[model samples]
Target: MSVTASQVHGAVQTLTQSSDTLFLLLGAIMVFLMHAGFAFLEVGTVRHKNQVNALVKILADFGISALAYFFIGYWVAYGANFFADAQTLSQGNGYELVKFFFLLTFAAAIPAIVSGGIAERARFYPVLIATFFTVGLVYPVFEGMIWNGNFGLQAWFESQFGYGFHDFAGSVVVHGVGGWIALVAVLFLGMRKGRIRAGKHTNFAPSNIPFLALGAWILCVGWFGFNVMSAQTLNGISGLVAMNSLMAMVGGIVAALIAGKNDPGFIHNGPLAGLVAVCAGSDLMHPIGALITGAIAGALFVYLFTYLQNRTKIDDVLGVWPLHGVCGAWGGVAAGIFGQTALGGLGGVSITVQLLGTITGIAVALIGALIVYGIIDKMSGLRLSEEDEFNGADLAIHKISSTSED
Candidate 1:
């Protein structure tokens, strides 16, 4: 007995959907693990006294960000709501749920990025409040505008430039938005106390290079899922995305090693710089294009990190702005350049569209963050008192250390 063609098609569709669901589930899990990388990266970079606070913040922020994204952010961005019965929610083989899980991890990254910049001196509750507002309201608005095309901005871009802004993954949406907001948070929160005075800078050498390297390695591994799994469907997956990400990662490592003159912190962060820069165009650029984009991003991170620390005295602990903000924005713009067919790419991009869209994204992110952070600042304040700050966040906020008491 031969099966009918319709029956065979139905079976294939179901199987395809199942594969997509599993693919997205894996992506969600991988991105979720990047939060651990975020925590450990901060744990290593900050003073030993503040180490435990770093761990606590990443975990706690994940929880709060989930609530915000589930209740409001997802709805605002994609008109997706988990309010239905389980059976109804289970439509599409529960793929929507898994997709939500995936996007939540991205939304959660905003606070994880901020956690670093505000590391030692932030007041815990106020930052949490800011996290809720940011993830709930600010992030979703721009996310909708870009990814979901909620505001007709994509159409406008296409009309004017012959192509819509194209961030295949989320260099601008996730990393750029997070980094820009982090910059505002760091600026508003002020520099860590005693870091600089009387035209002199004090160094807070990383407490654990191993932990930092571990964090970088974890993020590097997870980023494959972050970039490749962004396809969201098995049929959409591309080997090019994987190869481009790999090439960019190597480029970032080599550039950072050379530019940083063998600084361990810079060396570890180099791959992150590359990954961030390639996120927007990974599927479009040639391997060589990815390498160039990543090399440029790695060098940019090293230079800007030093400039922010010394020349400007910004005190962004993990240099989230350079790694995520600057490089992510560069990724947004680079996609237009490197993604073009003329550049040995898969084509279908416009630098004009990318530049405008990137500018719009970063602008909204910065403004929204400033407003939220400013309000939190004026209401209960954004920073710990000098006494609490000098005492270290682990003791002042949580009354605990990484190691046991005597």
Candidate 2:
């Protein structure tokens, strides 16, 4: 009537595998929902006329990115492809497949990040083409080098410095690279039509504050999965990551509330700024350290977003350059700072190594973006015609609108 000890062990092993697979699958779903967050964030930030286009772009770009990553990008990053039969692919209970799905969400984020910067003006098909190449070739190159240890760069870092370059999640690999590339795309596309009418730049505000808040909320909720699930298995899971992420999120909110002078848009986006910055060192940082990191990121986003709009004449609508690019890079370097023994962290990191890795990531991203956006700009072009810009991307590209009342 009782089970054997061997049977108990076998049951436990099966349970562990299922738990890991389910954990990853849940992580993938959470990250996937962050795309919805991406869509609504763009929708709420853009003019009402561009809302439909914003939604469409996020969904369409995800499809294109998945295809690219599945067929080519995954191979480039990990040297592992699903070229085998169903049974062979089914090995490891298809956990690898789900893991692919998890990472693909991150890959798809590059274009989603770019979408906010180029909203209401970029050409549809050309952007899709660029996304294909960026995800397939550009992103995977840097991803492989950092995460997969493909180029011996991590080894070199360890040899030269005391420890390897550690991102933990993907402050540099995902957010930083995506932000820089988005900046280049924005530069190539130029300001939206009449963005600088009468020798003065006009300030356009978000049309839907509620939607914007919702987007931020979804992203904030899902980010725990994005950060925690990076552990990818039950045994590797840590409550510290969850607590750090929570602290960082609120730190960003409070900082933005102060820096932005209680602006609703800034208040909503504050948490996201925090989340992006904490992604690198979440595993190692103390709660207060994460808070400080997030606070800095929030201030950075507000100041740099304003600077780009006013001083630089760059129409990066989302301020992705600050929120993701600058802060993500800071997160990389901050990991070294806060992850040091003297700072009450887990230790095994160096600022010098972090700086080198951060700088290298920036260099790769900038170069890759310039080449891709430059070629596309010169060839098929990156922006819509003047008429299309005036008419709005919803009507011009998607042939639809957000409201039926009109």
Candidate 3:
């Protein structure tokens, strides 16, 4: 049982490799469960009549995103080296696999956002098709250009400004992408029944507040994985990332509670606001900075949700724009302000670059989504029939009722 020096060295390497792989896999699983949070959140936001429709949409999106990521999205988002030299296309599977899981979570998230936009009124098949084009084709192109190194926008930014853009998780890539897609889908689907009549509002409350609360809580839990796991490499910083995420969530909750003013929606969406806010710079900010960033996100979520609903008449079924889009932007910008290199010594980019990156990301995502949605709208007609919408997507599209006996 005498171990040679080389063998001992090999054993330690293998053990370390195994530990890293285990951590990565665990993070992936936790990220996947965020889909459950999305499903419940969408279901709770809409009327019960659309429950099965919402569930089926979430399941289909996840499945489609998985396949799409495996085939193309993975390579597109993180397969930079593969395309760098076409002759060496086969040399990047290790990196590609890691990127696939990371981007798959993002792809899943975009469709989840769309669910809220077209809730109760979309044709299931068409929505599924939109999800494929979006996650498989559109999102990866921009994301790849930013994070994948060789082909990413970061290189260009670095070359021009002497510093590259940084997004710890995917404030712009995941949440911003999802939010813009939701915006376009909402435009195509039009308003819900009785939403606007002669410039007046209608009464449309959440079907299940308890369900919404549960879904929000689950999302808060999964968000730790969503932000920290984005680091890709686990180390001491992982704990710090998790701490930032938790504190930001707390800040979001406190902000929401302070602004609640007898509004249940604010109370429900506060923690999510926090989570989304911290996503952009979870690894960069101090715990106190996270709190401030998250609190601002929560307050903004309340205000934005109200503005979109009342002024714009954009009936976001579950407030995706506020939760993901607005807070995501906040997170991205907060990175510039609170990104102290002393703590972790990461980002060297200036606040101006961060703002530019955030704005550019949002604009690109919105325009891309609008174009895609317009094309889809022209070809397939995005909305359900008026009759179908009235009856609910579940009954009209699936030929089943939520109240049906087993």
Indicate the TM-score of model 1: 0.98
lDDT, candidate 1, residue 57?
A: 91
- Please give the CA lDDT of all the candidate structures: 0.93, 0.91, 0.78
Residue 53 error for model 1, in Å? 0.5
TM-score winner, 1 or 2: 1
Q: In model 2, how many backbone clashes occur?
A: 0
User: Candidate 3 on 1-406: residue-level lDDT in tens?
Assistant: 8999999998887676555555666677788888888888877788978988888899899998787767787767765323445445423234344545665787788888778777888887778888887887778776876676646467777787777777878887788767877877887777888888788876478888787787788888888778877766545347778898898889988888888775776887898888887887887788888889889999998888877777776878788877888788878788888886664435575677678888877877788788778888888888888998988888898899878686
In candidate 2, how many Å is residue 346 off? Answer: 0.6
State the lDDT of candidate 1 residue by residue for 1-406, as single tens digits.
Answer: 9999999999998998888999999999999999999988999999888999999999999999999999999999998888889899987789999999999999999999989888889999999999999999999999999889998999898888788889988999999999999999999988888888777887689999999998899899999989999999888999999999999999999999999999999999999999999999999999999999999999999999998887786989999999999999999999999998888998899998899989998998999998999988998998899998888999999998788978
Record all residue pairs in model 3 with backbone atoms less than 3 Å apart, i.e. clashing. Answer: 145-152, 145-153
RMSD for all candidates, in order, please: 1.0, 1.3, 3.4
* Alpha-carbon runs more than 4 Å astray in model 2: 1-9
Q: How far in Å is the alpha carbon of 402 misplaced in model 3?
A: 1.9
TM-score of each: 0.98, 0.98, 0.92
Model 3 CA RMSD to the hidden true structure, in angstroms: 3.4
Supply the TM-score for candidate 3.
0.92
